[model samples]
Target: MATQTANALRFLSMDTVQAANSGHPGAPMGMADIADVLWREFLRHNPKNPKFANRDRF
Candidate 1:
């Protein structure tokens, strides 16, 4: 599970930087765990259905 998330994060970071054509993807790419924790833990959401209108997407 953790490995899958890590790989997904790498692809996401790379894609985002590639799309924007600016900023540093490397930093976020390296700090995926911290990003994951902040988003998956501290951030608010509806666990049952995160896509629900009232929930924050990220």
Candidate 2:
């Protein structure tokens, strides 16, 4: 799941950069794993209600 999540992030980042022809894709590609871990483990929120009044902010 971690690998999949990281790869998904990498794909999105790379795709955006490729499409825009600007910015560095390598940054997101390199940090995907770290980001995936952080979001999955410690900084999560309800996708459907990310701005819920009672939820703690990341």
Candidate 3:
């Protein structure tokens, strides 16, 4: 599942670069797994209200 997630992320980056005709894919492709894990485990958000004006989004 993790492998699939990373592959999907890489694929998305590839598609994005192709569409935009700019940006480098190496970083996004190589760091997908790390980024995925970080985002999944550490990222915080409120889909109901993204701008709560209290939580530091940084």
Candidate 4:
């Protein structure tokens, strides 16, 4: 699941760069796994209310 999540992030990041025809893709690709693990295990925020006062701000 974690690997899948990481790959999905990488793909989306790459796609965004490709669509824009600009920006560096290496950072996103490299950070994908770390971001996935952090989000899954450590980060806490509300998807429905991203700016909630009590939510962790990354």
RMSD in order of candidates: 3.0, 1.9, 2.5, 1.6
Please report how far candidate 3 places residue 3 from its true position, in Å: 0.9
Better of 1 and 3 by lDDT: 3
lDDT of 3 by residue, 1-58 (tens): 7789989999999999999999999999999999778656676766798887664353
**Per-residue accuracy of model 1 over 2-57 as CA lDDT, tens digit each:** 66787789899899999999888888788887767777678778778868776666
Q: Comparing candidate 1 with candidate 4, which one achieves the higher lDDT? A: 4
Q: Please provide TM-scores, in order, for all candidate models, with all chains considered together.
A: 0.60, 0.82, 0.69, 0.82
Q: Count the backbone clashes (under 3 Å) in each candidate.
A: 0, 0, 0, 0
TM-score of decoy 2:
0.82
Whole-model lDDT values for every prediction? 0.79, 0.88, 0.85, 0.92
Q: Which candidate is the best by lDDT?
A: 4
Candidate 2, overall lDDT? 0.88
Q: Which of 3 and 4 is ahead in TM-score?
A: 4
User: Tens digits of per-residue lDDT for model 4 on 1-58?
Assistant: 9999999999999999999999999999999999988898888888998988877665
Question: Total backbone clashes of model 1?
Answer: 0
